[model samples]
Target: MKDKTLLFINGDAPKSLPSPANYELIACTDGAFHYLKRMGFPLDKLAFISGDFDSHSGSDEDMYEEKFILTLDQEKTDFHKALEIIQDKGFSEVDVFGGSGGEQDHFLGNLTVAFAFKDLMNIKFYDEFSEYYFISNHFTLKGAKNRMISLYPFPSVNNITTKGLNWPLTNESLSITSRIGTRNFAVEDEVSIEYESGDVLFFAGNKEIEYPTIY
Candidate 1:
């Protein structure tokens, strides 16, 4: 288990949570506090809630009383506000749930944050189906044999190399104007990816995939 933080937003919660040992803390966006409380979650375990509070439709003011951070920025979404707090608290690894399965616009907005914050933190968006994240320039995936891996270049990516995948890439380029890697499967227990520049979002077709520890 890793020392990461779990963040819950206004979207639906999964059937089960990740092991408690993997997370150091739990946080919620203002939009999720009431729903989580109504669903009978452990409020005492909640560290804080950060957001503008315009989307909170719950009447339980007590849930966000002291835990609320009044971020009035309208340019960013509620998830972005909460993510800023996570960074301020110095948490590098974060798994976010309830950020999808709500409004389609909100789900798309969450992707914007995921890509924007790729380099700032190790963040992943999780739903009932799968978990996805932005892969670093050079990273490795362990215990990933036969797992469906999809790599989407944000706009363009250069010099991509891969090993242990069904279709290997040797310094190939994936650009928005040209080719994009999707529905690619890992053919070995470990998959390695090396790239020079640009954002390449990776998706695992499962609940979640374990990434090798970065030193």
Candidate 2:
């Protein structure tokens, strides 16, 4: 949490305020800035707002003049733009909220953007109930046994293995569209995930994720 430097607020963040200690820089996409401010965020905490400005308030224009960068490039999503800026600033790790709990299309788009940046940065997405991230290699997720755990493959994966889960996979193949791992439960103090090829998105039902002993 404190180690994370950037916080990205997407268009559909939880209505409750995220703890300020979670990040040093606050960035928002689409009209999330308006949403955050309306939700009682102090203006000074914001670093910048980036989006196509298709849904922002007219009143916030002059207010965020210097802080707002109008990115009219329709090719990239706001999440991508924010990551690019974060990378340009020399920081690759970011915790993003509001990736889900929104329109179905937007939520899925956010997931795609996260995978797109998997090689570029350390990215995590936070929603009201859980935080999610994708891994191309071996990964560990620590949580209490019986808590919810989900693993979804990006199209396809090979030679996947797991430990500390109620139902474990040993060198199994899982695909996103066809065979997905959902509604799984942790069975030990920590859950382990490893795969030989492709990306898998791991979901922890809560905010705090314990590191793998080997991490």
Per-residue alpha-carbon lDDT of candidate 2 for residues 28-100, written as tens digits (9 for 90 to 100): 7756776677677776677778888777667755676688878888898887788888777777778887778
lDDT value, residue 11 of candidate 1: 80
Best-performing candidate as measured by lDDT: 1
In model 1, what lDDT does residue 168 have?
A: 86
**What is each predicted model's overall lDDT from 0 to 1?**
0.81, 0.76
Q: Give me the overall lDDT of model 2.
A: 0.76
